[model samples]
Target: MKYNRLLCAGIAVSLLWVSPCPILSNEQNTSYASPAPAKGRAYYEERGDIVWEVPTHRKLIALTFDDGPDVSNTPAILDLLRKYDAKATFFVVGSRVEKLPHLVKREREEGHEIGNHTFLHSSFQHISRNKALSELDQGQASIVQATGAGTHLFRPPGGSYNDSLVKLAKEKGLKIILWSWHQDTLDWRKPGVHRIANKVLRNARNGDIVLMHDFVHHSTQTVEALKIILPELKKRGYSFVTVSELLSNREKPDGLIEVNK
Candidate 1:
């Protein structure tokens, strides 16, 4: 997934700090999965990645939002999660953490997981291992400084990861998490709410991880889609969990363990 990195950086540099809130509220409306192989499932074939989806039968799935802590879209997304009683993992950027520290703390207090998404949201392909480590170090520092919590989860910006990046993250006591290819809502494209909803609901399965964002305005549509997805999936007997908790329940052994339970 090639990210609009230049665009993201521009937005970061130009925006001044604002209080976090839902997009539908005033204050300048703004913004902001999965595995399982059923027939016609969107099976992603990424080579050399660490963790994508947990291969399990626990009826658990993880919803992960990336490039966030945005003042515009984050709070509303948080509200929706609480409303649904759904827990998610937020992969937040470092500078965004500095801009909206309260939101990070709020996410922690609300029982959501926060992971390092890099200092400037640099793509893993563009950064060397050392640079990647530095990104996590500084990103985690900001998160800890703001929320009084530290994260062991590291997700490379733009879903671009490599062996060296994964190795360094593990050495730093971090886990590299990517999303289930079948469940990528591509909400960043602002594809309509129904499209996003259909894409996820039609394809998702147990032990999957979903990728989404909290930085675009149309992300409110992502929120709207979640309104439909949450109840529909709950009706289907699916349970929402954080990325770490999903991995914690993985059938474990050594590195990259397979399910055997």
Candidate 2:
């Protein structure tokens, strides 16, 4: 299938109407670093409670979609995953899960994993600790309510987190899940389909937890990008699996490569 170039061009222009959200800036591209003050992936990696990428020798990668269950984009993504016989993890916003429980249910039925993205997609850096806990609690609750299953994974909105937030996730038995730094597609910015696809194709590696979004406003760059990413990756002998599965196959420290960043 071909990317709709004209449609993407129009969406690129419409991107100007979108408000700024939590996105890592160019300056913050340090190997395992996050934006200022927030604990980088390495800090959590030392604690062994957060996962940016699994360390495994197998050609396995976990494709994760965040801020989703959107009517416009999610189903199309699910369709592509099904077409490629690939499994993915979706970090869903709680509010959207409540509104579109059916889509969440469909994700579960199709052998995909669901993780909590927070009740309102609020950044922990901006909210009080209590409010952040509530966001986590409610987000987890909504997923259980929608699918009768709870998630063990939690992704801080915009990849923003601190020491306390990481501790809190541990207290709740949720592992903080971040994306491989190189695998971020920036699809939320309405980058063209080729850019999005190339981001994944060029940087893809074993145990990569790819970051993509399904809740982009007035955009379908992600869905179109996957049209190229999935088949191409599969041809390269990469097997897509859920994050948990990737973790289960993690290599021992002796065999581990320092590529999770």
- Cα error, candidate 1, residue 86 (Å): 0.7
lDDT of 2 by residue, 56-105 (tens): 88999999999988997999999999999999999999999999999999
- The residue pairs that clash in candidate 1, if any, are 31-215, 31-216, 32-214, 32-215, 32-216, 33-183, 33-209, 33-210, 34-180
Model 2: runs farther than 4 Å from truth? Answer: 1-34, 38-40, 256-261
TM-score of each model, in listed order: 0.76, 0.83
On the 0 to 100 scale, the lDDT of residue 110 in model 2 is: 97
Residue 17, model 1, lDDT: 63
Task: State the lDDT of candidate 1 residue by residue for 1-261, as single tens digits.
Answer: 236888887789878667786444431221111122222222222332357888776788899888888887898888988987889999999999999999999999999999998889876554444566678899999999989979988887776644445557768888777788899999989999999989889998888999988877545787788889888988898888998778777753354545421
Cα-based lDDT for every prediction: 0.78, 0.87
Angstrom error of the Cα, residue 207, model 2: value is 0.7
